[model samples]
Structures are given as C-alpha cells and as structure tokens.
Target: MTACIDTLDTPAAVVDVTRMQRNIQRMQAQADRLGVRLRPHVKTSKCAAVVEAQIAAGAQGITVSTLKEAQAFFQQGITDILYAVAMAPGKLTQALALRRAGCGLAIITDSVAGAKAITEFGRAQSESFEVFIEIDSDHHRSGVRSDDPVLVEIARILHTGGAVLKGVMTHAGESYSLNTLEALQAIAELERSECVKAAEAIRAAGLPCPEVSVGSTPTALSAVRLEGVTELRAGVYVFFDLVMHNVGVCRLDELALSVLTTVIGHQAEKGWIITDSGWMAMSRDRGTQSQASDYGYGLVCNSAGELIEGLQLRSANQEHGVASFEKGQNVDIEQRFPIGTRLRVLPNHACATGAQYSAYEALDERGEARQWPRHNGW
Candidate 1:
C-alpha cells in the first residue's frame, strides 16, 4: 500500500524530502564557494539514500564515525571514505578488513600510541593504511593541539612507519556554542588557521602533508576562506535541528527532519497537550538548553512540518511528551489539539533524534511517504 504521513504510526521519524535536497545543495554550494571538496560526515543521517543525494550534489567523498558506517556505505559502492574519529586499538581489525576488501577507508589518530598501533598493525598485515592526524582546533574535544610538538611526532610516526599519512583534519565542534555571525566567523578562522598550522609543522619536518580538512556545520557555513584547506567536512547540516537553528546557521523552516507524533490526550486545566513521543522517541537530547532559546525537549510543529509558535515539548518521560506554552502564555490545549491529532516535533539535536529510529518516512512534495532505512549501533 502507498503510505501517507497521515496514516503512519505516531512517534515516527519523518524527513521532508524537498527541504533535505535544498539543504544538500546549500552545503554543497558553500563548499564550492570556498574551493574545497565537501566530504560530508555521514554520521548524521546514516542512510544510503541521503548519502547518495549528497554525492550526487558534488560531494567528493564521505566521513564516518565508525567502521560499521564505512562498511555499510562501501557495500553501497562508495569507495572513498574517511573514518574521522580517533582510532581505538580494538577496532583496528575491522578497519583493516574494510581496507583489505578494497575500501579506501582512511583512519585517524591524535596520539603517539595510536599512531604506533596503526603503523604496527599495517606492517603486520602487509598494508599501508591511509591515515590523518586529528588536530584539536577548538580545544572542545579530542585531537593533538595544533601547536603541540606531538603533532609532528605523530605524523612522522605514520610516514616513516609504513602508513600513508593523508594529512591533517580538525572539527571546530565548539562552533555549536556561538550564535552571532562575528563569533561564528572568528571560530571558523581559528579552526582553519590552527589546522593549517599543524599541517605546516608536519611539512616543515619534511613529511608529506597533502590534505588539510576542517569543518563543523557552523564553521563550515561561516568560513570566509580555505586558503590551506583541501577539504571540508560537516554532518548535521543535512537534517538541521533546533540546535542548528539556535546556532544561526539554518532557519526554522529549513529543518528537514522531525518526529511525527500523535496528540493522544490533554490536560485542559493545566493547558497541556500530551503526546506519544518521549525521550525514548526523541533520544533525550537537550541541546538547545544553553542556546538563546530553549525548547524544553523540542519545538512543537503541525503534522505538515510547520512550527506552531508559542508551543514546545515542555517535558518528557519514557513514552510521554507534555506540550505546553512558554510560561505566562495561556491557550485552550484541548480545543486546539484534541485526541488523535497528528503533530510533529522538531528535535533539539538531529543526530541524537535520528538515532532513535531505524528508518525514516521520507515525505515528498505530493504528501506521499516512502521508507528509507538507517542503521544504528557501533
């Protein structure tokens, strides 16, 4: 049977196809304008259809956080893949298996021990794995500091120890904390300069450093120049959530992913509209809490994917989401949203929300929904 969103089950993951395609084009255009290849991080959608659309829109390759994603996409005929996370010793066997099967799976590391492990594993397996040294551009997460002497030491380890040292890459994840253009741009420049500095240090030490990759959705959209960067990488821009909206990179209307839920009941006296979607359905991500606007669990939208202003998911239990207005606002919840009313909730974090579901009901312009399966787990 041909399915429509109106007939689908509640608490389902839904994607607005048109908006998603537009998002893909926007990010691809940003990469083009900066004169760098867009290696979109697939950790956002983790769906083949979405990745295929990204590649069709001029993305050169893909970035993944896990070898499972690498294997999944590689089986879909994508050969060029970068496992962007710092490599753990336990996962080397799976990474090697992928490379041996003809997948151009490049792994990364930020420590001397990690570098030695990769090189030793490569030598034992008679393989030269492509490797990138992760740089901690924003000091928000893992990576060697761009100025740290260990930067060159790690690079030299890979180059002289049998691994193909691809280059340097960094993610300015701290960009998520800013909302203004000035701050975003400043962090973007910082991200670019710091990553490039690390690459220069490597080359100054007489090592071959070809690629300088840097990005995060906010930084990628705000970067004014990529003078030393050969590639850009970003993940969550594809299904922008409330977090990205509050970060000022995307508008409320551009959000492509939402949770389709049903208004199962109401608390008229308390003026609350209860829904079937809870943290279990939305994955408990309160990413918008520190932003300029805090949508409790999420912002409430109509089933058609339009925000119903003044309303948000105020609280959530395991399977119950309570929707109410901002403090001081008064509205008749029962009359406005009665039993069996189908509604949508825009999440605070797209990646976390997406991880809750196994597949997406992609809604096209004509109101038809088709299933697009996504993978979960490590």
Candidate 2:
C-alpha cells in the first residue's frame, strides 16, 4: 500500500479516482437497467479528468449549469451538451459560436419573452439551434407550468422561428423537502408526469417532441420508475455528500471527495481542536438543516483517514474550523492532534466545496497521488 503521509496536503480537495470511477460505473449500470440515457451534470466535478471518465462510462451527453461550463467542455471536444439553465441574452453570442464550432447544443427556456429573445438572436445569427421548454414540476423555481398554454405556445414559436424544439425539461426541487423514500418517490412520479404531460401537449399542438428530461439527485436515485424520461441529469451522485446520506441515497463510504486539512491549534480548557479548513474550504452549504444530525460544517477524520468517533466540526469561520468531541469520550483533542497534524473533512455539498479549490489531488486505490487542474469563475 502507498504511504498515507505522501498523499497529505493542506487545504486541498482530494478525489479517490478509483472510487469515483466505480461510482460512475454504478450510475451507468442503473441507467442502463432503466433503459434511459444518463446525461450526468458535470457541475459537481469541474475537472476535465472527471468529465472524460463520465463520458467513457456511457454518458450519452453532459449537462452544464452555465454557458461558461459549456464553453470549457466544448473546448475539450465534448460536443452534444445541454445547458440546463435558461439561456440569457448576454450568452447568445457565445452559444452561437459554440454551434458554429459543431456543438450539438440544447438550451432551456420557460417564457415567451425568453423564447423571443432566442428567436431574435438566432435570426440575426447564421446557425439554427435546439431548444427545450422548461416546465415547473413543483413551482419551486424557474419554469413554465407543464399544462400551461404557454408551453404549447412557446413550442410553436420556436418551431415556426426555425429553432428545433427538442422537448421539455423539469426538476423536482421539492424532492429535497422529502422526509422519506416514499415522499421522494412521490416527487419523482410528479416530475415524470409533468415532463411527459408537457411533451404530450406540445405533440398535440402538432410539434415534433422527442425528448423528456428530468433531474435531481434525490428523485433520480429513489424514484422506482422513470416511465417517460428520455434522459436523467444528476451531478451529486459522483461524490455522495452528507446531504445524500441523510436522504438515504448513499452511505458515507460511497463518498469519493473530501477536503484535506491540518490541525493548526487547540484549546485544552475549552476542549476544541482547530483546523486550517473553514467555510472557505468546506463551503457554507448546510444541507443537514432538515436532518436529525447537523454537522455544523462537516465530519472530521483522523490523520489515518478514519472518522473521529463522536467528533464533529461544530463551527467554522473564514480560515479556521472548531471541532467538538463527545463529552466524557476521554479523547485527547489537543495531544493527539498536535500542530501540523493532517486531517480530512467530508463536506455537506461536494459541488460547492469542490469549487473552492483550483485543482484536485487525485488518489488511486493504493493512495498514489496526481494533480488534476480545474476551472473557476463565471
């Protein structure tokens, strides 16, 4: 086995490449069993190394949250990308450039105003584009009502304006509010029904509708059925976080990404151990608000990479983290974790935490280390 100290680094994100590949394979297998396309959301791991692995693992296409992400992946030769967010006017020129470079791009829109803006932009440009109508599954965020007349109206406009109407897309944001598997399943069913119904309405309006997209880590994993979903867009499954664990989607062992930190100080009287990792390293994502266990920031692991039993990172500031140990556990919060000691912290949200770093130190099954560069901003 490779020595653990050799892979140690302070304030860096570490990804177990072997475990990550396994997670990709497992998700692909599930998608194959369901006979649905797995278009993973690449926002979780902004590293091109991870994106290439997902593509190699049978991802039909990839989903990006921003046009900038699409541009980065496009430059890497990953065509056939879906910009899941609504296309804004400022991004029209960039989108057109991507299309000219031979990207099979599809963007989402929810209102006639947005559609008209795209139509006007397309008319001024030299290339035609594919568009998907965004449907509001639970009205928790941006999207047109699935059954709204505007759905049919927008499809007709896009088709008549020479924009290819691919289909409809919706996300069950409410699924995160679920307290049980049954509740998640119910939300998933609702998401599927809404997407399918929107597509049917567009078809009924004499438009060719070929795809129905549904996404969300919670609903995608727990949903017993994906009756009419043409593609699934999920990002968090690659690095199962504390939130996913609380929702019963994955176990802590399945998590592949974590922040590597070092103990910088300690207060023997107050019984607190301070680490160099803080909100800047772990992110401000408190996904455990609804869960019974609220790890203020994240779970702390010893230098050996094992969880410190009954210990939790109770609070974090800009650059310091305070860890609390269980009362009467007799653990040496300071003696055992002297200054310069290294530790690993599991974040509540992998995406937010991963974004804070410029690169990921990849580790193999034997703990060998390699660096993978990532992009940020915009």
RMSD of each: 0.9, 1.7
Estimate the TM-score of every prediction: 0.99, 0.96
Number of clashing pairs per prediction, in order: 0, 0
| TM-score computed on alpha carbons, candidate 1 | 0.99
Q: Which parts of model 2 have CA positions greater than 4 angstroms off?
A: 1-7
Model 1: weakest 10-residue lDDT segment is: 326-335
lDDT tens readout by residue for model 1, 34-143: 99999999999999999999999999989998788999999999999999989998899999899889999999999999999999988998999999999999989999
- CA lDDT, every prediction? 0.93, 0.85
In the predicted model 1, the residue pairs found to clash are none
- Supply the TM-score for candidate 2: 0.96
Candidate 1's error at 131, in angstroms? 0.3
